[model samples]
Target: IHRQAHLVEGFSEPFRRAVEREIRRLGVEIWAGCQVKAFGPEHVWLSDGTELIAQTRLWAGGFQVPSWLSTCGLPTGPTGALLVDKYLRVQGSEHILAVGDCADFVWGSRLLPKIGVYAVRQGPIAAQNLLRLIRGQPLIPYRPQATVFVCVTVGNRVAVAEKGRLVWRGYSATVLKNFFDWLYMRKLKPLRWQEFFY
Candidate 1:
């Protein structure tokens, strides 16, 4: 279920359609442009006075900034994310950097969506920029990628992925998803003396 008209609103129309197809194929209902008024252990009540049996209900809420950030007197975006400059530094403040969901990282005229891809890309640059700031060296400005990869595993072993004009589905997309998931999970593995280079 999604409150938005499109489940993946900012994504390409084809990507969104592909994902929706996979989800529907899995026998899961799509409740777009709707809201759940309340949910009990075995049932869910919708805002339109409809109740449905829901054995397992999953609710994914939107992100919210900490209340204390408002008290800090820093400039914030419409969603209350701290405004950040190109260098990922908090606007008007040096030695303070904000990224990911907590930051309103703007590119051109719009703020980048709060997604993991942007956060992962911004992380190393933010680290290097922070170091450069301390050493009085030039801080590197973060450039949002022209085409970021997006993948979603809908259900079973199926998935959908997109990058630029490229779109993928089913087995190929699932393989790509697994490969990226492996790379991400690799970082969580502990280092050993023999594998220090990893």
Candidate 2:
């Protein structure tokens, strides 16, 4: 169940369709543009006057920040995430930087999506900028790439990959997704400075 008709927003049309197609193929019904009116022990009512009888329901809707963000007296967006400039620095604090899901980094008029991929890419750049700041050098601006690839795991064996207009699914996509996941986890392992180069 989702508010958007497309599974992934701000992605290419072909990619969004591919994700929806794979999801339906897995025999999971998708309720797009659905507004949950009410819920009962064994059923859920939608705004469209449709009652769905289901034994299980999962609410994967929206994101929120910790209450302490507001209490900290830092500038925050409507979602309560810390407002940050192009360099990922906090609005008023030169030493403090914000990144990941807790930050509201805007490019032009749009705020960047709160996704893991952006956060992963932002980390190294943020670190570099911090070093530059420490050396009294100009900080490098964080310019987000136009195209961002995303992979979604639909089920045990099914997954979807999207990069602009390109899309991939099924077993190969699942393997590719798993490979990326493994690579991410592997990088998290503690290693010596010499091991990093190797």
Candidate 3:
């Protein structure tokens, strides 16, 4: 369970905080600000010079989208993110488009963060721009109105919420995060028996 703990941790702040809270509730203390320097067959090394000989370790680090846009002959940023214009069209190709994790777009002064929320917003904008191109109409610029909410699991009986500039914490927040997670999954995959499984 610890090995796969990152799956929940990497999802969102609410989830991670909730799980951490539970771990502490179980009497297991965790250290913060400790960075792992290396992993070997029998031990893990930390930046602080601490070593732990554990049979298993889980990386709760996070995720990155596999991007090979340049190999496909498209221009990409240093991070391999496909560079697209306002219409979500690939930088050098009028007919080519990029979306979701592979594409990178700037919203005003901010480089849009990679998250599922932006991908959901990009789908329709990309489709609209594609349609306009086919019909020879003026293309609509994809202006994403971005908002993010994060819930993190804090060790036992507490969670944290970052909804806009607002923040909240405690057990109520944890319950709210869990409920929202259930709602999101159900909305995405309505056929799943979320209430039973989750």
TM-score of each: 0.85, 0.78, 0.66
What are the root-mean-square deviations of the candidates from the true structure over C-alphas? 4.2, 5.1, 5.6
Q: Over the full model, what C-alpha lDDT does candidate 1 score relative to the true structure?
A: 0.83
User: Which of candidates 1 and 3 reaches a greater TM-score?
Assistant: 1
Poorest stretch of ten by lDDT in candidate 2 = 189-198
TM-score of model 3 vs. true structure: 0.66
Report the lDDT tens digits of candidate 2 across residue range 104-181: 988888888787879998999899998999999999888888877688878777788877667888777777777766
How much lDDT does candidate 3 score?
0.70
The residue ranges of model 3 lying beyond 4 angstroms of the native Cα positions read: 1-38, 46-50, 153-158, 178-184, 191-198
Question: Which model scores highest in lDDT?
Answer: 1
lDDT of 3 by residue, 20-65 (tens): 6666776866766666778899898877788888787876545465
Predicted candidate 1: what Cα RMSD to the true structure?
A: 4.2
Give the lDDT of residue 36 in candidate 1: 93
lDDT of each: 0.83, 0.81, 0.70
